[model samples]
Target: MLIDTYGRVATDLRVSLTDRCNLRCTYCMPEEGLSWLAKPDLLTDEEIVRLVRVAVTALGVTEVRFTGGEPLLRPGLVGIVQECAALEPRPQLSLTTNGIGLGRTAAALKEAGLDRVNVSLDTLRPEVFKTLTRRDRHQDVLAGLAAAHEAGLTPVKVNSVLMPGHNADEAPDLLAWAVAHDYELRFIEQMPLDAQHGWKREGMITAGDILASLRTRFTLTEEAGERGSAPAERWLVDGGPHRVGVIGSVTRPFCAACDRTRLTADGQIRTCLFASEETDLRAALRSGAPDEELARIWRQAMWGKKAGSGLDDPSFLQPQRPMSAIGG
Candidate 1:
């Protein structure tokens, strides 16, 4: 079941369709985006499906999520989703997106077998959104979220990064807006994945800081449930119905139970989001490798996964690629 050296079973696979994004988020990538992979270098839709099939049938993968600098940027995304759905014992499928382009493509994506989506929306204010992402597409994100909900993409999730001076004050307001909109909200403590190499701990907001502010308005009861491989720690808000999540990657680590792996658009396998290196599978894929061989490469990679993501290590180094390039 693709168990790692530390007995962590790998069931969730995040595949990057492309490293090209529309917006340049401050916490994700540099204002001037990095050089993107050429068309030939990016894995084809057929290659992606073949790998998913191997992960599902051979390596015991049960959930597959398509990510990207922006997955919707890929023209073949729906087709890829369709092929993955056609797999026997089809895995749970989902996507992570910036939500700018989702307004026009939400229904098409749902029809193509995408189960749900997690949209990145940092702020409700248009000016703040522009300042954070270097793009004035806040309206587009709002419209896309509405379209996703309208398309029956149940429990549409909104992911916000907690940067202190930037959008920290909006924490309570964001939660209230999410509750009113009936969308799940997640506050992700900013990790060391930015392209600027300026992720100082002092400038970031912790999960405790957010919850403490939230406590002033509503009662948050931690949900004593199985977190499994999911990154976010869930909570029941005020009462039963509405809930909120906080991904305390920095302050409260959940590395021991990490059950996820990532594949870059160019086909490199990353066991952790903050990994220093990645195993290149694109070379083998282009060399006419078979399914079993690909499976072996994946297994070899997972077998070497460290006990944790190593964020706490004094020698911990940031990944060469930015968070956007590495996928969600």
Candidate 2:
């Protein structure tokens, strides 16, 4: 097990299939975008499966989520999912995407063993979407969501990041939409993960702000239960049956129960989202290191994980790699 001194064992793995994204959301990167990782630098399909195999077979990861600048953009995604699904103790597979190409790929992905999807959609208005994303693909996202539902991706999740001036007021409407469509909605407080490093605590929306906005339209009762390692704080919308989630990653940090380990597209292990250090597994994998050696390096890296993401500390510095590179 990848157990830290804090006694937290990692059972969830986030794998970044690529660092390249189709949409340049204002909060994620510049309009021109950041430098893309070279093809050779990225892990091949076999390499990715091998690392995942090690994590599941050796390190005890049970849930595998594929994220990226936009995972749907990966040409070999379906094949990769198929391979990962074939592991001995097959891990639950999911994808986090911007939902650009999902309309065309959702069914294929579901067939390839992808259990479900969490799409990033901030607003229902096309104009606001364009303004925030600097792209005119709002309808594409909605279509993708519908397609995902049609493909039987049960409990399709929508991840919304509330930026203060941009669509922060849409909380209630977003929730209403989710309830109507039966999509589980989660509102995440914007973190200091932007490429430009322009995030300010005062300017970013908080979980409190989201609840305040939501309470105006709906009665939310805190769901009874320990959140375990889940990042979202769930609330029963209105009376029962449906719920909304708030991930206050900054203000209500859940690092104490964090069970996630991240693997970059290039095969670097990131013990934390805000980690300043990354352990390289690619070099060793390419240099003929045995699977046991690879697992040992991974265990050592997780053992050294910081107690928490120091977002609340005065000395906290934004990670050098932005959210795009870090795999959200």
Question: Local distance difference test, per candidate?
Answer: 0.89, 0.94
- lDDT, candidate 1, equals 0.89
For 203-259, candidate 1 gives per-residue lDDT tens digits of 679889999988888889988878876788888988858889999998889989988
Candidate 1: list runs displaced more than 4 Å. Answer: none
Q: Over 4 Å off in model 2, which ranges?
A: none
Taking every candidate in turn, the Cα RMSD to the unseen true structure, in Å, is 1.1, 0.8
In terms of lDDT, the best-performing candidate is 2
TM-score of 1: 0.98
Per-residue CA lDDT of model 2 for 1-328, tens digit only, reads 9999999999999999998988989888989848999999999989999999999999999999999989988889999999999998999999999988989999998998999999999999899999999999999999999999999877799999877777988999999999999999999988899899988887788999999999999999999988899999999998879999999999999999999999999999999999999999999999999999999999999999999999999889999999899897
Q: TM-score winner among the candidates?
A: 2
In lDDT terms, how accurate is model 2?
A: 0.94
| Candidate 1, poorest ten consecutive residues by summed lDDT | 27-36
Error of 2 at 164 (Å): 2.1
Clashes of each: 0, 0
